[model samples]
Target: MATALATKPQVSAAEWEARQQLAACYRIFDMLGWSEMIYNHITVKVPDQEGAFLINPFGLHFSEINASNLVKIDIDGNTLDGSPHPVNRAGFVQHALFHRHLPDAHCIMHSHTTAGMAVSSVEGGLQPTNFYACNFAGQIAYHDFEGVTVRDEEGARLLANLGDKRVMLLRNHGILVMGQTLPEAFIKHWALQRACEIQVATASMGTPLLVPDAVVAVHQRDVHMAQVPGGPGSADFAAMVRLVDRIDTSWRE
Candidate 1:
C-alpha cells in the first residue's frame, strides 16, 4: 500500500482525482455485489491524455482497490508507472479498444454478475419488461463470445459491434457499460443489472412478459431527457460514495 502511494507525486492533480474517483467506483462495485473476484475490471481515463487510463491491479479484489494502488497504462497495454502489480492483459485488450475508439467514453466497467451472465445467454438480449430495461431500448449492442477477448484482432470486432452504443451484452460472457463520467457508467451498470435480475426472476415463473411498446418509448425519451449534466445520477453517486466512506474509508487511501 505504501508503494502505491509513492506514485502519487508523479501525476497531476486532475489525474490524481481521477484515480480516487475510479478507486471509489471499484469499492462501490464491491458493495453492490458486482465484482467477480479479481477477474472483471473498472477503468477510467487520465484526464487530457489520449489512450492513457487507470485500471485495478490484476490480483487484488475490488474491495482492496485504492487511488494509490490503481495502475496507469496506455492503449498498448504497457504499464507507465512501473507498479509491482500487473494489469490484467485481457482487461487491457478489451477496455483499450473502447477508450481509443470512443472519445467520450471516459469510464468503462465490465462485470460478470450472475444475473448479467444469465441474461446474456438468452435469445433476446435485455428484454424491455420493466422501466429500468425500457431505458435501454434500442440502445444496447451485442457481441458474440470469442473466448476471453485476449487477441489483438478481437478488439476491432468488439468495437465494431459496439459502435456508438453505451451498453453492450457480450454474448455468453458478461456486460460492459461505458460512460462519459464514472457515475454515469456506474448508474448504467446498476440499471442493467437490475433489468437482468428482473428478467431472470420473471422468466423462472414461466409467465408471458408484457412490455407495452408505446409506454416503453415514452419512458425511454424521459430517461434521455433526465440524463443531463449533474443530474440525479450524480447525486446518487455522491450518496454511494458517502455510504462507502462510512463503511470502510480505506478505499480512499
Candidate 2:
C-alpha cells in the first residue's frame, strides 16, 4: 500500500535461486531498453506456491537490482517478502491476476518499449508486416489502457484480455508477455517488441510490403516451437536463462 525501502532478507537456497533469476530478468529487461522507469515489472511464480508471485521491489532501478532484492507477494497484492519496500500495486493487479487464474503462467514480463508502444497506438495494432509478426499471428492478445492499474477492480479486465494467450499488446499503453518460464516470457516479449519495431519501421518506409500467408505463419510458429526449451508449447526458457548469464553474471549473485 505504501512505498518504502526495506532490507533484503535471508532466503532458503531454492528461494534464493528463484530470486536470482527473477532479478536477472529485471536486468535483461533493462538491457533491452524495455523498462519504463521502475514502473514496469517482471514477475515469476514462486516454484512451490499457489497464488504467490515474486516481483522487483519498488524504488530500486532495474539496473541496481540483485537476486536478494526481489520481493514475494500473494495474489491479492500483499507482500510476503516481510519487507517494507512496497511492491508496485499495478504490477500486482496485472501479474497476480495472471498467476491466480492461469496455471500455465509461471513468468510474466511487461514493458513500455517505444516500438511496442508505437504499434499499440496503431489503428490495427500489431500487423504481420514481417517474419517476426508471423510467429505471433492470431496468437497475441490486446488490453485497452485503463489508466493506471492501481486499483483491484481492473483485475477482471486484465484477466479477460490475457485469457489463455502468452502474449498481449496493451492498446495505447505497452506490451505484456507471459509464459511457463522466465525465458519463455522474455523471448515472447522480445519477439513482440521486435515485431512492433518492424511494423513501425515498415510503415515509416511508406513502401508496400508483402505479408506472409497464414500457412507460413503456422510453420514459423512450429519452427520456433523446437527452440522452446521445455518442448512443444513451451518457450525456449532454458536458453533465456543462459542468456542472463551472458548479459550480466552479477545477476546470479
Candidate 3:
C-alpha cells in the first residue's frame, strides 16, 4: 500500500513577523489606557497572498492578548480559524471595510479612550491645538453616529467617512487610525490620542487662547521630522515593540 501523505501546518516568516507586530500593537494600546474593557480592536492584514487578517480574541482583555491568542478572519468578518473566544463581529465590520478598500491600510486601530471620545463629542472635533495635532489639519474625516457598528450595512458609511484619509474621528463614537505599515499606524494612534488629551485639558481651563495659524501648524508638523533621529521608514518603531516586550514579554509567549 502507498504511504499516506500528511500536510504540515504552515506559518511563513512574514506571518510570524506580522504576528509579533500585531501582538506588540495590542500591548502598546493596553499600556496607554486606550483599551475599552475588551471592546476595542486593533487588526493587522495577514501576510503573503492571503487577504485575511487577525484580531484579539473577543472577551479577553487587551492585556491578556498574546501572539497565539489572536483569531484570524476574512474581510466579511467570518472566523477562518477555530478558537475558544468568539470574534468581535461588530468591531470587525469597520476593520474589514478598511482592509478591503484601503490598499495602504495594512494595519487598522480603533479605540474608545476617554479623551478621544470627549473630543469626538465636542462641537469642534480634534482641534489643531498644537504641533502634534496639526497633521490632522484639513485631513481628518468624521462619521456621524449611526448606532453601534455591528452590521455589514455600516461598512459603506465607514468607508465613506474614511475616504482617502488615513485618520478619522468617529463622531459621537471614537477614533480610528490606519497606516501603510504597522508601526506608522500605532504611532498615529498614539499621537491622535495624546492630542485629544491636550485639547480637552486646554478646553477645561475655560480660557480663549490663540491657536496656531494654519501656516504655523503645517510648518511645525513638517519640522517634527528634523527632531526624529530618522524619519518615517527609519524611525525606531521596533524600539517601541521592544519597550512593550520589556514591560510585558508574556504577550510574546
* Top model number, lDDT: 1
**Could you tell me the TM-score of candidate 3?**
0.89
Per-residue error (Å), model 2, residue 84 = 3.1
Model 2, runs deviating above 4 Å: 1-8, 208-210, 225-248
lDDT of 3 at 224: 60
The TM-scores, one per candidate, come to 0.94, 0.87, 0.89
Comparing 1 with 3 on lDDT, the higher-scoring candidate is: 1
Ranking by lDDT: 1, 3, 2
1 versus 2: better lDDT goes to: 1
lDDT of 1 at 161: 88
- How far is 20's C-alpha from truth in model 1 (Å)? 0.5
Task: List, residue by residue over 1-253, the lDDT tens digit for candidate 1.
Answer: 3233434437788998898899998999899988887889999999967779999998888888888889999999898888778888889999998898898889999999999999999898888887788878889999999898889999788888888888999999998999988888988998899999988988888874668889888887677676646753687788899999999987767
Model 3 CA lDDT for position 245: 75
Question: Could you give candidate 2's per-residue lDDT for residues 113-196 as a string of tens digits?
Answer: 899889998788877778778788788888888898787788788787776778888899898888877766777787788888
Each model's lDDT comes to: 0.87, 0.77, 0.77
